[model samples]
Target: MEEMKRVLKETVDRLFQEMNGRFVRLNEIDEKFGFLLDLKGLIYDEKDYDLKKKCNELGQFYVSDIDGNELDE
Candidate 1:
């Protein structure tokens, strides 16, 4: 009976550790996705002419369409 109790405890502890690791990774991914969505919305609000000029000056490339695709200038 004592050995059985020890085995059960070890199993539960391993399962809890695995779950904690997954939860932490998921939180990190959610934060990154939220930041990208905000940035895309801000860029969409600007006028096309202004965006183009800014891109040229900054030497960075960006898609003017609704899609948020960026390329290296």
Candidate 2:
């Protein structure tokens, strides 16, 4: 009976260790994915700002052209 108890305890301990390792791995994956998402967001924001600036410049050029101002100089 004592030997059976020892074997059961060892099995439980091994299972717990495996589960803990898996949990740690999953947490690491989550952290990495979060970082990637933040980077993607930042890139998109920069692109949006660049597009907005271009649009504004184009609008100014159109207005200046209508006023007979030289745009190429």
Candidate 3:
């Protein structure tokens, strides 16, 4: 798990180094991470995750599109 996290951080840093990753606020990062976890995609880490009533927990805050793009607010 630590290795996975390290790889992810390295990937983000490398990508930002390659281009522009603007300075987003901490609250915005929280919102974006929440958006990612709450995203309903064609693939699921757990097959029965939907049956667990998780999205209901997310409520109005989970509004990103499948591609993780923010829709009009």
Candidate 4:
């Protein structure tokens, strides 16, 4: 169980980093923030995995092109 958790955590961490990088690159394009990358609120369920159990949230990523002050048009 411990080993599974550790591996899961590592996988989640790597996924978050990759997602963040992709979001950043997309944001760099001057094409008016077409879509928002909001993976920070992702919910993971262990039941969905091979192990029919429950695990806590492993990681999160939140990278966006638009700012809070920006208006949606």
lDDT winner among the candidates? 2
> Whole-model lDDT, candidate 2?
0.58
Candidate 2, poorest ten consecutive residues by summed lDDT? 64-73
Q: Against the true structure, candidate 3 has what lDDT?
A: 0.50
The C-alpha stretches of model 1 lying farther than 4 A from their native spots are 35-73
TM per model? 0.47, 0.46, 0.27, 0.41
Q: What's the alpha carbon RMSD for model 3?
A: 13.5
Evaluate residue 30 in candidate 3 and report its C-alpha lDDT on the 0 to 100 scale: 62
lDDT of each: 0.55, 0.58, 0.50, 0.43
TM-score top scorer:
1
Estimate the Cα RMSD of every predicted model relative to the unseen true structure: 8.8, 17.1, 13.5, 18.1
Q: List runs of model 3 lying over 4 Å from the truth.
A: 21-73
How would you encode candidate 3's per-residue C-alpha lDDT over 1-73 as one tens digit per residue?
9999999999999989655544455556665445445556324545754422334434445545322222211
lDDT of 1 by residue, 1-73 (tens): 9999999999999999999999999897664344344565456654532443333433332235333323212
lDDT of 2 by residue, 13-39 (tens): 999999999999999766433433455
Candidate 3 at residue 43, lDDT?
45
- Tens digits of per-residue lDDT for model 4 on 1-73? 9999999999999999999999888776422322222223222423434211111111111224322333221
Pitting candidate 1 against candidate 2, the one with the higher lDDT is 2
